[model samples]
Target: MASKPMNVVVIGGSLGGLMHGIVLKRLGHTVRILERNPSPLLHNQGAGVVAGNDTQDFFQHHDLTHRSLAVTSHLRHYLDVKGNEIHREEYAQQMTSWDLLYYVLRANFDRVESGYCTLPPVQDGEGKATYQYGHTVTALRDLGPDAGVELSFRDRDGESGKRTADLVIAADGGSSTVRKLLQPDVERKYVGYVAWRGTVPERSLSAAATAALAEKFTFFHASGVQVLAYLIPVPDGALEPGKRLMNWVWYVNYAPGSAAYRELMTDVDGKAHAVTLPAGKMAPRVWHKQKAVAAAALPPQFADIVAKTEQPFIQAITDVLSPCNTYLDGRVLLVGDALAGFRPHTAASTSQAAYDALMLDAMLRGEMSRQEWAARTMEYARRVQRRGVEMGERSQFGRHPYAGTYPG
Candidate 1:
């Protein structure tokens, strides 16, 4: 399909990297995915994701199994303090869980055995894809002229090696090592809030809670807080009733550097993390205090969902927008959150990754120039990043600066 098959190296084996790898490999390019994690990434720290158009389209085109991936909600409802619905709208959205998507993608890309997908990897005689875990990229070098880029890496066993490819893709996420190496001045800007997130088994919830949240996108907003709940597939992608999970996120403001923020951000081992405190690692005392707050502040239905959660986690909201995603004369590129990290209000992170992968596919197919692709991708990133910030400001700070100017 292409003028010539190019060797490709993808850093990070998460959604963004896997999407790019799958697309390029299908186009007859040799691809190698180096993941820092030492094992199969079957677990995700966060929960449900709204399956936007880009995500749906990517699966339709690339995923071979063509399995059902989401649970649909046909109604949207807003709740008051008493848990009574004050506003109702007919809205339909497909909700997907993080683990389901990850394993499905992995099954499609490399056919790693998992409960999500049991099919073997497809052998289409296009190109070969190799996956390596426990490889941490240590440095990057761009050879001059037609030569490609070289990357040095050390594995978990402290063994170091190097590889070169005609192109390099950095999908390492918000705290990307590749991004930091290229743009040392860029950093993650913390917003004045954090999200408390957890999931409860549908059967574990009370009848009242199930009646309120089942098959409905539910939300509640207070002066400085916003909470939402929706149903997603279980860990193995089961969507049947009573086998699903009710995922909820409550956004609460805590000023940076305050004692409250410090106490909440510190994990059970007394270590501080800049972004997420993963499930099952949160300190008991911190979780209890937040549960007490939920009892006092949240509506009864929402409060019950929180109480039933056994391992709630916290994600500190942060934003990062790089000036550009192209680097090293276009030999290296940054996509997804590495290019522009959005606030969670937009719920467009996975969609952004899908969009980036689609655009990269177009570029590799000679459908667009590298310059054009870069401009289009950066425009999309900035627009989504701005919209996420505006939405967060409106919901968390009661500001309507972008009321009539929201991006489509």
Candidate 2:
């Protein structure tokens, strides 16, 4: 009455892949996570992410704690550049620090591996799983048509090795090497806007300034641009008694091929840096312009918070989607940004990753055959990917606000 254990290999040790590995391991499978980072400490572990009830269900189902939830604030008002208040909607949901979520999930995963047992605890075959950091998967090749999947990777010491698994899950993010190998024609397109983000201590501002940002999400809209500000309780503690941090994002339209665009995308030393800009290197002066714009165009209360911040970071917004009907290839399946990278407008990246994990878990449990799983999961991905593409198209030229009506 015992079921055989499945050997599964997951590429990318971030949220989606880690979640998939955890769920499969729980279902009596031998799961291994191949992480390219040197170690767990080197991961970026993003700033903050938003999630709704459906996402919360995934966390709760996996026995995760809610204590790590960040400060929740409702969107109170949307104001135009002239300080005129537009629509006001209340979003009653929870906000959380992305790093906190990753840490919590990672901790829970470590606690679950006591000693895997067979389906009915037969005297043979207990499942075992491992997380192998510094293993960068380089190639994935089909092993005939019946041998399942084979993965080639390089370890920390630059040693090359190969692995075979019954299933392979690729959650390697936007510039996913797996995706590039499988589907060469698909590419990432840059939107005409750059997102500048930073955080400042609440105590850095005066009393009036702090009150303006107190426990509420606020957005300031302008023609072809928008700025959003919110208070997120750091992993350390709450907002009172000392000081909490306020996170801010400014969307500015930058012509793709102009000099200013090149300068804005340049590195801190004024040298041309290739890929997207990394965190915390933007010159203070460049961000000063954004603060000045906010001060001149937004409500005085919101402007005051902007003027008090220091050392903001900038990133170019780009859109990437999978080619038609190809999110999966044989035993390897793509998830999260690996499959579809969306504009930040919907704030749905984390939620979508959670959904992928849940659906994939069910499929691995034999609830659906490999063919059925690929069809159903790809359909789900297509729907979400379409929404993301529409959002990206609307967000092009930087004409939408976080609180405005969704463009059809």
Candidate 3:
């Protein structure tokens, strides 16, 4: 176990990457985060996060300001196929949007200027952590058994550079470049379905709809499909009623490698995408067709929510199972989506990244060996991946009145 500090470069700048950078810096390492984005992140515009325990721990441990970034609901409402509320149970959970958490993490990371609407960081430290935006990581290779790791990078100015770090942490997300380099044979398998997601501000809804959804976690299940709706802070991470928004996702199945799948990935410009079509980039015809389906199949409440949304997006759900996470004589490591992409059903990806960071920090501080860290992380990834699959499959559950809607 080595307690001495090391230079670390983290690829990818999303939640996973940022978390790793923060955790590593706290453990006394010099850390730099490479974000492929050309500029600072645009806050308050990302999808919602369920905020599992591990996710919460990262914020709590870092002492970041999070209380104002999330919204809480104490009731769970289950609706019928027609969108009629059939049963209600007391539930308690706190959720935040990805934009909010990202900005919060970014603020604590370095002296970079977070955008206009970001909440101030709860704890600002020595500023040992820095982020390099517009820098894309090209490749990483070890010089020799003990000669350190070399990193190749390309900046937005069309200039290229190289650097060496004692450790390389690849948290570049599910479509990770480092993961592709290390495990060339692995692929993100499309899980035969897609999710249609959107958000409508609370003020945009009717009084009845507002009353039904405000401060509530809600859902509706259909044959091979599931619809979930919840409230989240609005564009500025504000919790004021009118300023909040109702976000929803409808998961519907489609065959992988099918024409429908390819068509769904098509953008407004007619360019076919390999994965998601960003908000407002979905061809109008596709959203129009989905509106028609919502009108006929979804509960009236949800149908209204979908109809009023101004900027909806589509994401193709995919997962990967990577059996190994450490390489280069344990000098290089993979974390978060790079190690293994899991079905979102577990809501574990963010939390898992935190756990990975925490565990890695501990091991580097002499709590465990690199070999043990690799084995434990690999086992944990497989377990979490399998659990997500099981949870994704058992889609229909809860109060019995809606059993008929289950996709048998």
Candidate 4:
């Protein structure tokens, strides 16, 4: 136990929020997480994720199982305009689903087997952390370093209340309400493109399709369009071959103010969505149009995956980087996508969250001063954010440096 256990409130109870809660609680802080959704907030049905070093290190440090949590691919193949593989390289990527990693972090924090991870929580959380679903954090403010911070929240039924915490961690996501409150002028810049993502069960595709796509991070790029696909565990984290899902992401450039952009964002309810069209929400005509476009642009291998998928979704690629992450004399800190939203090309957002948690823990443990903590974390965010943008531009423009290289 610490000399003083600060009351910590984490906004947005997805990956980032849960990660911060686990790390803070591990250091003897009393934690309360506020999530807006009544049910589990599935950001997407599932996202194909690449677990980099920061992620694996976090799991190891926390005693969580990381190996069996993901589907792995030993090689990557690049396809030509036709479906023939023109480039083959050894590319080992441990690809996990968003749900799997989220639940693993949850299980570790609660010290229970959440059915997502075989490893039970190694740390004790008798009364240290509490997760409150259906609670919306409407407002919060720093009352000075001495007075800590005050937060106002509203539940699903319209009841609203206030509470005080010695520290506040806004791990809210890219479209973060807390972040807007702090820096309203920092808008999310639309990158004039969209990604259509979907997953097909291994059993649904033909044997030829399986052989072409199975066990590899396959990619196709041509004329400013890119498609990447790989296998991922089933919804329940089942890694059996037939039980896994083949996840695909097709990136297409779309002008922000074009008529096509407006039509693509119209949901089934006839409402225009700004960012993401979730699974089962896109209008029938819109999705049909997307599939037709995929057929015309992508190679037949990827076109087949799109045609077979039951629920394909689209997200307008956007960028947001805050000038500063720390505020109110360090009583309030922004973490994860809330602090800086990155392009998904590098799949570095979750890794950044994991790094933030570890670094914040170190700071709380008195390893660095306030200024040093802020400078280092902000620097990391800037560097990774820049790298992600570079990769995104390259992939979006069909100009990858590794276009013809086969490392193996």
Q: Against the true structure, whose lDDT is highest?
A: 1
Candidate 3 regions with alpha-carbon error over 4 angstroms? 42-45, 115-127, 396-408
Q: Which candidate is the best by TM-score?
A: 1
Error of 1 at 354 (Å): 0.2
Which has the higher TM-score value, candidate number 1 or candidate number 3? 1
Residue lDDT tens for model 4, 1-408: 124888989998988888889888788788999888886544556677888888877777864565477778889898865677888999798888898887777776655456666766455543387888888888887787677899998987889989898888898889988888888999988897888899999888877668889889998876567788999988778998889999999888888889889888888998888888888988999888777876766667777898999988888898999999987777789999999999888788989888998888778788877788788889989998898888788877657643432211
Write candidate 3's Cα lDDT for 266-285 as tens digits.
88898887657788788888
Taken over the whole model, the C-alpha lDDT of each candidate is 0.88, 0.67, 0.78, 0.81
The residue-level lDDT of candidate 3 at 18 comes to 85
Clashing pairs in 3: 82-299, 83-299
Q: How well does candidate 4 score on lDDT at residue 31? A: 91
Worst 10 residues of 3 by lDDT: 396-405
Is candidate 2 or 4 superior in TM-score?
A: 4
lDDT of 2 by residue, 131-179 (tens): 8889999998788645778899999999999999877888888788888
* Cα displacement (Å) at residue 321, model 3: 1.6
Over the full model, what C-alpha lDDT does candidate 4 score relative to the true structure? Answer: 0.81
Better of 2 and 3 by lDDT: 3
Candidate 1 clashing pairs, residues 3+ apart or interchain: none
RMSD of each: 3.7, 5.4, 3.0, 3.4
